[model samples]
Target: MPKISNQNLFDALLDSWDRNNTILVNLLQAFSHGGLEIRAMEGGPSIAELFTHMHYCRLIFVLEDAPECARPINRQEWASEQDPSVLARLLNESAAAVREAVKSRVEAGQDMLVHYDHPILMLQHMIWHEGYHHGQIKLALKLAGRPFSDDEAGLITWDVWMNKT
Candidate 1:
């Protein structure tokens, strides 16, 4: 097997992050189109709850210290009393922070570490976390009898987005 260079790995990480963001944008767009409701599930969170949870995860992996980041928070607490517009603003801010952190890491030539719990790993986790919750949100929508648009799924696979250009 060919060895992958640090730059290549970093590029792949960024691609994953970009694809996640694309899916998030699609989900949010669908949610904004109305018909979506905030409702509790038997053992899962509602769509609103999941959105806030995603924001909290972003803060955890991207902003908090390694030790503090390891601790978990109540998704209900994070989701409660949140104004939709405020949530949107915070989400955008979190996305910007992730982008800046990735850029800084790449510029510093410090992306070659093979074993370390660093910002890069946190960023990578954020991508997967977002994608995972995105799937849950779609399922929640389906359960609520709301339409699940193709937007989010269409953005998950990198090749699909690239082929459009």
Candidate 2:
């Protein structure tokens, strides 16, 4: 594909990630440390675990998909959501790494390290994966009676994530 094409694909993927971040930030802002620990169910991960795993998932994408991208070992020694600031910071950092890895893979074109891969597919998987968990976050907040606005809920809609074109 052409450079512009790669850029456009990257733009769309990043936009999706941005919406995911916006929604998660709004959800987290509604909670305290204790609230983040509330699991929506006994079998499911808590809100904090969800966020932690989400960050790790992004890191895994880069590790599995883009050999050229460099990132440190992001240890999950503690539940990140216990500290709001730490959770927010780690999420942003991991998300940015995801963007960089995807961008690098796209720019490298055929030289990208996979024999049967495209960054778009990886990005799509990331977005869809987060989206599946986003609903859990929303439910966890609702179950806790954590306050949020319709605006925040709506921000994750396709219009916001897809309109940057």
Candidate 3:
């Protein structure tokens, strides 16, 4: 059996992680403040709430497994913030924390066994979870009469995750 080097794997993982984070940032920046209030269903979470929830999930994971790398935030406070800029700032901060936590763990050769047994699984969990919520947020935006063209949506969600061409 060939002994494979994991350096490439780690680098690719980090790239995938960063790509997923950019999806959120791009989606948020694509819309206006009023669009944050849009909801897909009458009682479903608004775009702001969905974003807040995604950040909250990341924050909680980091706080529990990598407190030193976590940037603490009041979930209620962030959810109440209607300003898109503020929300974007908060999202970036949390994303950085998660990135740091993952990077540090990889550098230190550590495993986040408290929950997901390993760093890669945890990272995949975050990426998958955020992707699900991003879909909902986009759906909400579409329901609110603001939406990306199919090409734009393809670019934002699909092409962005692909390797640089």
Highest lDDT: give the candidate number. 3
Residue 119: error of model 3 in Å?
Answer: 1.4
Give the per-residue Cα lDDT of candidate 2 at 46.
Answer: 84
The candidate that achieves the highest TM-score relative to the unseen native structure:
3
* 2 against 3, candidate with superior TM-score: 3
TM-score of 1: 0.66
Q: Local error of candidate 2 at 37, Å?
A: 0.9
Which ranges in model 3 have alpha carbons more than 4 Å from their true place? 1-5, 163-165
Q: 1 or 3: which has the higher TM-score?
A: 3
The parts of candidate 2 lying over 4 Å away from their true place are 1-10, 32-34, 75-80, 111-116, 147-152, 155-165
Ranking by lDDT: 3, 2, 1
* Model 1: per-residue Cα lDDT over 1-165, one tens digit each: 566776588777776676666557556666555533455377566676777778776655544433321334444544643355656666766676666665675566454233335557756677777878777777777777774656645554444447645
Clashes of each: 0, 0, 0
Which should have the higher lDDT, number 2 or number 3?
3
lDDT of 2 by residue, 13-125 (tens): 67776777766655566555457787787877888898888878777667766756747746673344577667888878877777787777767674335532666666677
TM-score of each: 0.66, 0.75, 0.87
Query: What global local distance difference test value does model 2 have?
Result: 0.69
